[model samples]
Target chain A: MNIAVVGLGIIGGSFCKAIKKYTDHRVIGINRTKSTAEKALKEGAIDEIGTHESLENADLIILSMYPQAVVDYVSRYGEYIKKGAVVTDVSGIKRAICPQMTELSEKFGFVFAGSHPMAGKETNGFDVSDADLYKNASYIIVPCNAGDSVVNMLSDFAKSIGFGTVKITTPEEHDRMIAFTSQLPHVLACSYVLSPCCPNHKGFSAGSYRDVSRVANINSTLWSELFLENKDPLISELDILIENITKIKDAIKAEDTDALKALLEKGREVKQALGE
Target chain B: MNIAVVGLGIIGGSFCKAIKKYTDHRVIGINRTKSTAEKALKEGAIDEIGTHESLENADLIILSMYPQAVVDYVSRYGEYIKKGAVVTDVSGIKRAICPQMTELSEKFGFVFAGSHPMAGKETNGFDVSDADLYKNASYIIVPCNAGDSVVNMLSDFAKSIGFGTVKITTPEEHDRMIAFTSQLPHVLACSYVLSPCCPNHKGFSAGSYRDVSRVANINSTLWSELFLENKDPLISELDILIENITKIKDAIKAEDTDALKALLEKGREVKQALGE
Candidate 1:
C-alpha cells in the first residue's frame, strides 16, 4: 500500500515514521515546508517527498494538519486524489472538518474518514516526531460517509501502528468528548498558570502543579483556532469547570470543612470509579 | 546522629529508607500503628521500632504526620524530647502548625522548625514508600524562631537525603506560596474530575486528561484537613484561578478569536519563562 502523509509536522512526520517502521507501506511525505519532508526522507521515514501528483497513487491519504488546513488541502487537491482511496485526518477537532471533507470526497469520488490520534508531546515539528508516538494511545475514527471496508482498514492500520484502542464514533460525539478531555484541560492549564503566583512556584510546587500546568506550554495559534472552531462545546465545558471551581472556592471561603470534604470525596469517588 | 521519625506513613517511611540508604544515622521509626514501625524495622529502613522513650537520644526528630497530629504528638511528648534537639515536620500547611510547634519547642527545650518536602505519589501508606522519593525534589523550611545553627543543620540534612534545593522562608510566605503552587492544583484536579464526562473518558482521553486528573485519586481525608487549615490562602488562589478561567470562557463564548489567541499566548509565555 502507498500511504501519502500530508503536512510533515510532528503528527504527520510521526505517522510516516510509524508506517515505515511497522509495515511494508510506501510513505510519501508532503509538507508546506519542503525541508521537513526532505529531512524525513533523509531519515528513511518516507520513500519520497511527494507532489500533488502523488495523490493519484496513494492507497491512503492522511491529512495531519490543523482543521482549516485539512479542509483547504482537500478542496485544492481533491481532483488529483485517486478514486476509492481512503482520506483521513489527524486533526484535534472534527465536527466542522469531517462534513466538509465528506462533501469534497463525494465530488472527487474518494472516501473520507476523520481520525484523531489521541497522543502528542509538548514540542512540535518533525524533529521531535517519533515512530512510537502512537504507542498504547487511543485512536478515534469518524466515518464521514466512508464505507465499512475503509473504516475497518483504517482501524487495522491504527492497531498495526501501535494504537491500543480504535473507537468508531460520529464527528459530533468526537468533538464533544475532545472538548472535555483535550481542549478543556489545555484551557485549564493555561488559566492555572496565568495566576500571579506562577512565577514564584519554583520551590513551592510538586506533582499537582506539574500536572496542572504541563499543557500550558502550548501551541497558542493552533489551539486558538481549535477553540474558536469548537466554540459551543468548549465553552460549555469551561463553564462547568469554572462553576465546579467556584463551589470549592465558596466552601473554602466559608471555612466549611464538611462541605469541602464532601466535594473532595466526590471527586475522589469519580476518579476511583474510572479505575485508571 | 540519632534520627527519630514519628508516624511511619508513606512520608515517614520514605524518610527512614532514604536516611538508611544515604547516611549512617541510627533511624528510630514511630507510628500510631506499631505494626508499620515494626515492618519498617524488619525491612531495614529503620534500626529500631521507636518508643516515646527513644526521643531522649535523638539529635533530630521528624514529625512526618498530619498537621494536627504533629502538634498533638509534640504537645504530648514535648517533655521526653532531648534538649537542644532540632524538631521538624512534613505537614502540607505551615502557618497553623508552625506557631503551635514553635511554642511547644520553647516549653520543651527542643528547637522547632517546620518543613515540607515537595514530593508525593497519588497512593499512600508504608508499603508504597520509596527510598529515592526525595531525589532531586524541593524541600521548604519554615524557620519558626529556630537559631541559625539548627537551620543550617536541617538544610545540610535535607541535602544529604537527596533534596536538590532547600528554600528557607517564613511560615506566612510558605503558606501563601503553597496555596497557589500545591493546594490550588489539588482543588482544581478534584473539581475537574467531578465532571459527569469523566467516566466515559476512556478512548476520548490522552495526556491532558491523564495529567489533569492525576491528583484526583487523592487521600481525601488528608487533603480535606490540609485545605481547611490553609483556608484563606487557598481560597484567594482559587478565586484568582476561577477569574482567569472566566476570561478564557468569555472570549470563547463571544467567539473572539484574537482575544482567545492573546490569552493562550500569555499562558505559553508564562510557562516558557518558568523553563521547566
Candidate 2:
C-alpha cells in the first residue's frame, strides 16, 4: 500500500516508521514545513517525501495533526484523494472528528475510519518519534461503516504497529472514554500540581509526587485546544469525578469515620480489580 | 546507641536492616509475633530478637507500628522506657499523635520525636523489607521542641539510614503536607481507577494507565484508617484541588483555550521546579 502521512510530527513520523517496520506500506511524508518533511525522510520515517499534490494517487491517507488542522486539511485537500482510498486519523477525540471526516470521505468517494492510538509523550515533534511508540498500547477504531472493507484494513494497520488491543466502538463511545480516561486525569493532575499544599512541601516529594504530576507537565497550548474542542465530554467526566469527591467531603464533615473508610476501601477495591 | 524497633513490619524491619548495614547501632527487633521477629533476625535485619518486655533499657526506641497501635503501645508500656531514652515514631500522620506523645514523654521522662520516611512498597510486612529502601528518599522530622537534643539524635538517625534529605517541619505542617501531597493523590488515583471507562478499557491500557493508577491498588484497610484519622487536612486539600479543577472545567465550558493552556503550563512549571 502507498500511504500518504500528513503533518509529519510525532504521531505521523512514528506511524511512518512503524508501518515500514511491520508492513510493506511505502510511506510518503507530507508536512506544512518542508524542513520537517525533509527531516522525516532523512530519519527514514518515510520511503519518500512528497507535496500535498501526492494525495491524488495514495492508497491510504493518515491525518496526524491536531483536531482543528484536521478540519482544515480535509476541507481543502480531501477532495483530491483517490476514489475508494481509505482515510483515517490518529486524533484523541472521535465523535466530533468522525462525522466531518465521514462527510469529506463521502464527498470525495473514499472510506473514513477514525482511530485513536493510546500512545503519546509529553514531548512532541518528529525528533522524538519512534517506531515502537505504540507498543502494548490501546487502539480504538471507529469505522464510519461497520461493513466497509477498510475497517479490517484499519484494524490490521493498528495491529501491525504494536497495539495490543483493538476496540471497535461508535464515535460517541470513543469520545466519552477518552474524556474519562485521558482528559479528566490530565486535568486532575494539573490541578493537583497547582494546589497550595503542593507548593508547601516541594522539598519533601518522592516518586509519588513526580508520578502524579508528570502528565500535568504537558504542552499547554495543545492540551488547551484539546480541552476546548472536547469540552462537552470533558465537562461531563469532571462532574462525575467531582460528585464522587463530594461524597468523600460529606463523609468527612459528618465525622462518619466508618463511612469514610467504606468510601476509600471501595475506591481501592475498584482500582485493584481493574488489574484483574 | 542501642536501637529498639517495636513492630517488625516493613518499616521496622527496614529500619533494623538499614541500621545494621550503615551504622554500628545495635538493633533489637520486637514483634507481637515471635516468628516475625525471628525472621527479621535470621534475615540479618537485627542484631537480636526480643519481646515487648525487652524494650526496657534501649537508648533509642523506634515505634514502627500502625497509627492506632502506636498510642496503645505508648499508654501500655510508656513507663517501661529507660530514663533519658529518645523515642521516635515512623507514623504517616503527626498531629493526631503529637500532643499525646508529648504528654506521655513528659510523664515517662523520655524525649519523643516523630519521623516519617518517604519510602515504601505496595506490599507490606518484613517479607518485602530491604535495607536500601530509604536510599535517596526524604525523611521528615517533626519535633515539638526545635532545639531539643532528641531532634538532633533523630536527624542523625535518619541520615544513618541512607536518607538523602532530612527535612524539619512541625507536626501540623507534616500532617497537612502528607494530606495534600500523599493522601490526596492516592485518593484521586483510586477514584480514577473506579471510573467506568477504566474498567471498560482495562484490557486496552498502555503504560500511562498503569503508571497513573499503580498506587490505587493500595491496602484499603490501612489507607481507610489513615484517611479517617487525617480527615480535616485531607478534606482541606481536596477543596483546594477541587477549586483548581473547577477552574479548568469553566475554561473548557467557555472555550477559553488560552486560560486553560496557561493553567496547564503553570502546573508543568511548578511540578518540574520541585525537588530540583
Candidate 3:
C-alpha cells in the first residue's frame, strides 16, 4: 500500500516513521520544505519524496498539518487524490476541518477520515520525530464522509503503529472534548507561567508545578491557529475553567474551611472519577 | 544524634528513613496513633517508637505534622522538649506556624528553624514512605528566631539527606514563594479536576490532562488545614492566579489572536526560564 504523509513536521514526520516501522506500506514523504523532506528521507521514514502531482498514487494519505492547513490542503488537492483512496489527519481540532474535508471526500470520491492522535512533545520538526510516539496514546477517528471500511483500515493502521485505543466520535463531540482536555490545558499552562511568583519559583517548585507547567512550553504559531479555529468551544472551556479557579479563590479569601474542604473534596472526587 | 519525628505519616516516615539511611542518628517515630508508630518501626523507618516523655532525649526533633496539628502538638509538649535542642518542621507553609514556633523555641530553650521540603506524593502513609524521596528536591530553611549556627546545621542536615539545594530565606519570603509554588498548584490541581468535562474524559485525555490533574488526588484533611493556616498569603496568590486565568479568558472571548499569542509566548518563556 502507498501512504503519503503531508507536512513533514513533528506529527507528519512521526506518522511516516510509525508507518515505515510497523507496516509494509510504502511511505512517501510530502512537505512544504525540501530540507524537511530530505531529513525525513535520511531518517529512513519514507520510501521516496512525493509531490502534489503524484498524490493520486497514494492509497492512503495522512494530513498531519495544522487545522487551517488541513482545510487548505483538502481544498487544493481534493480533485487530485486517488478515487476511493483513504485520507486521514493528525489535526488537533476537528470541527473546522472535518466538514470541509468530508465534502471534498464526497466530491472527489476519496475517504477523508479525520483522526487525532493524542500525543506529541514540546519539541517539533522531523529531526525530533519518534517511531514510538503514539504508543499507549489515544487515536480518535472522527467519522467524516469516510465509510466503515476506510475507518477500519485507518484503525488498523493506527493500531499497527501502537495507538492504545481507536475511538470514534462526531466532529462536534471531538472539538468539544478537545477544547476541554487539550486546548484548555494549553491555556491554563500558558497563563500559569505568567504569575508574579514564577520568577522566584526557582528552588520551590516540585511535581505539581512541573506537571501543570509542562505544556506551557508550546508552539505559539500552531496553537494560536488552533485556539481561534475552535473559538466558541474553547471559549466555553475557558469560562468553565475560570469559574473553577474563581471558586477556589473565593473559598480561600473567605477562609471558610468547611466550604474550602467541601470544594477540595469535590475536586478529589472528580480526580477519583477520572480513573486514569 | 537522636532524631525524633513527631508524626509517623508519609512525610514524617520519609524523614525517619532519610535520617536513618544517611546519618548515624537514632531515629525515633512518634504518632497520634500507636499503629502508625509500630508500622513505621516495622518498615525500618524508625529505630524505635518514642512517646512525648522520651522526646527530651532527642538532640534534633522534627515536627513532621500537619499545620494545625503541629501547632497543637507543639503547644502541648513544647515545655517537655530538651533545652538547646534543634527542632524543625516539614510543613508545606511556614507563616502561620513559624512565629508561634519561634516563641515556643525561645520559651522552651529549643532552636526552631522552619524548613519546607518541596517534594511529596499524592499518596500518604508509612507504607508509601521512601528514604530517597528528597533527592534532588528543594529544601528551604526559613529563619525565624533560630540562630545562624542552628540554621546552618539544619541546611547541612537537609543537604546530607539528599536535597538538591538548601536555600535560606525569611519566614515571610518563604510563605510568599510557597503560596505560588506549592499551595496554589495544589488548589489549581484540585479545582482543575472539577471541570464538567472531566467525567467524560475517558480515552480522550492524555499528557496535559494527566499532568495538570496529577496532584488532584490529595490528602484533603491535611491540605484543608494547610490552606486555612496560610490563608493570607494563599489568598493573595489565588487572586493573582485567577487574574491570569481571566486574562486568557478575555483574550479568547475577544478573539484577540495577538494577545493570545503573546500570552502563550510568555508561558513558553516562563517554561524555558525554569531550566529544569
Which has the greatest TM-score?
1
- Model 1 chain B worst lDDT window (10 residues): B30-39
Candidate lDDT (C-alpha), each:
0.91, 0.81, 0.84
Ranking by lDDT: 1, 3, 2
lDDT of 2: 0.81
Clashing pairs in 1: none
User: What tens digits encode model 1's per-residue C-alpha lDDT throughout A197-275?
Assistant: 8999998888889989998989988998899889888888888888888998888778788998899989989988888
Against the true structure, what is every candidate's RMSD? 0.9, 2.8, 1.6
DockQ score of each predicted structure, in the order shown: 0.85, 0.55, 0.75
Distance (Å) between predicted and true CA of A74, model 2?
A: 2.1
> Comparing to the true complex, what docking class would candidate 1 get?
high
lDDT of 3 at B120: 89
Give one digit per residue, the lDDT tens place, for model 3 in B1-276.
Answer: 899999877788888899889988899888889998887888788899899987899999988888767778888998889999998898888888888888888888998888888888888887787899999998988878888898888888888998999888887888788787788888888777787888888678788888888888887888888888778888887777778877877877788999988888888888888764
Off by over 4 Å in 3: none
The superposed Cα distance between candidate 2 and the true structure at residue A220, in angstroms, equals: 3.1
Off by over 4 Å in 1: none
Which regions of candidate 2 are displaced past 4 Å? A20-25, A146-149, B20-25, B146-153, B207-212, B272-276
Q: How accurate is candidate 1 locally (lDDT)?
A: 0.91
**Chain B, model 1, TM-score against the native?**
0.98
Please state the CAPRI-style docking class of candidate 3: medium
Model 1 chain A poorest ten-residue lDDT run: A248-257
